[model samples]
Target: MGIFKKPPLRGGKRNAGVPDDLWTKCQCGELIHTLDLKQHAYVCAHCNHHFLLPGRDRIELLTDAGSFEEMDHGLYSANPLGFANYERKTADLREKTGLNDAVISGRATIDSFPVTLAVMDFKYFAGSMGSVVGEKITRAIETATREKRAVIIVSASSGARMQEGMLSLMQMAKTCGALSRHQEAALPYISILTHPTTGGVTASFATIGDINLAEPGCMIGFAGPRVIKETTHQDLPKGFQTAEFMVEHGLVDAIVDRTKMRTKLAELLSYLMPQPSLSGQETLG
Candidate 1:
């Protein structure tokens, strides 16, 4: 019998589709190695411009190793509106992004301070809030309320999913209601807004957190600048709706750098949930 040999990859590389080396260009016209970018939490090292961080990566960055227990992994979109190509588009997005929906909700600990966490992945349909996404977030908040844990949501969305129509719009109300109950329980809720947190999302739970922190230079508003400009027909002020502008106007509590996000979050969590003493007594402050 003759020995068989496997065919070489089409691109003459072991990993055909994957590039061995990657370089990212910053908006400031600087190029940096991708590994270095990851080291800096995807922020531009030179200009300090914040880049889009994946939801999974964000969770890993903030939580202790092996501390995240995902809550609603099986919940998925069902094409409730029966819109054109809605099912196919959703299926394609699932295969492309490896996400059940835009939002991933779960239980996580920041420096051992337990909290209910939900992160929106923009790669999945612009991180739009659909029925499933809204349901998962609402459930996460409810879970936090029942467990007496803090709730932290990292939002990076363009708005409600248009394909789901009013179904998606209603999620705004549902999530807000859940957060209201969580608030009444006296539990801390932190909302972190990344670039492009807009539309119905801004109108609802995104702005209702006890502490709202936004990434540097992020665009956050109910509508885009062009839409507002056209509607109001007024010359908008410079830096309007940007994170810095919002912070200046007292809209956002602070603008956090991506590199120090984990440290800042851990610090906040520690302040919100002080550790018990060796004698097992927590001092109520």
Candidate 2:
């Protein structure tokens, strides 16, 4: 009989399944490689840590499969002040991140509970809040209110955009105003703080959630640790403004891992907006 050669295995690259190159130790410590990090829902596998995710990814993770419908997709920024390099910067960021602005606003369902989602994309100019971002978010809030759906704002921003000057700063108040309206309507607004959520974004609606949640190990504060330390000339507290710290300080309602976030959010929404009790109505008779 002629010698029979073994056929190749059904699955190619057995070792490829292993994520050996999916982690790297950075000066800040071990950071998971981006692809592997994403697979783990932006959580660091090395330390069981959570990293900041882009706006698009956050929406995808939070929303039910194929349930998201984006709102305010036509918005774009114009060079009103003619700030130096502003146009170039915006174009560069858009090209790099494939996003028009720092924030993405949309409607989606979390475990069948309707919700409005606004997620900040740090990849776009460090997810800086500007007039456009503020407008989009405000529109989202209004839509949610009209639709009677809960609102979820996921923040991962550097701060206010400087190129827009005071205009960017005004966004702080504008976004807060929109969130305030939602509060007045007794609508639930949940803020999920991701890594490095700071500055105007943090000072405004990011911290204004009726129920605030944060990913594990996320930096949640108004300012960066370095700036604070330099300004105060003192050593900051251990774990400083991390999500764990915020939870301990009662700043955040819970420190949930990405894996559990969707389920937890859905449960919370259910409690806050339960279906009308037909059983109770029948019993009342």
- Using lDDT as the measure, which candidate wins? 1
- What does candidate 1's lDDT look like per residue over 252-284, in tens digits? 999899778888888887788656345422332
- Kindly provide the TM-score of model 1 when superposed on the true structure, using C-alpha atoms: 0.89
RMSD versus native structure for model 1: 6.9
* Per-residue C-alpha lDDT of model 2 across residues 167-273, encoded as one tens digit per residue: 88998998888888888888888998887899888898898888999887888888788889999999998999988888889989898888888989988998876
Which segments of candidate 1 are over 4 A away from where they belong?
1-21, 274-285
Q: Rate the local accuracy (lDDT) of all candidates.
A: 0.88, 0.82
Against the true structure, candidate 2 has what lDDT? Answer: 0.82
In TM-score terms, candidate 2 sits at 0.84
TM-scores, each model vs. reference: 0.89, 0.84
Which pairs clash in model 2?
22-33
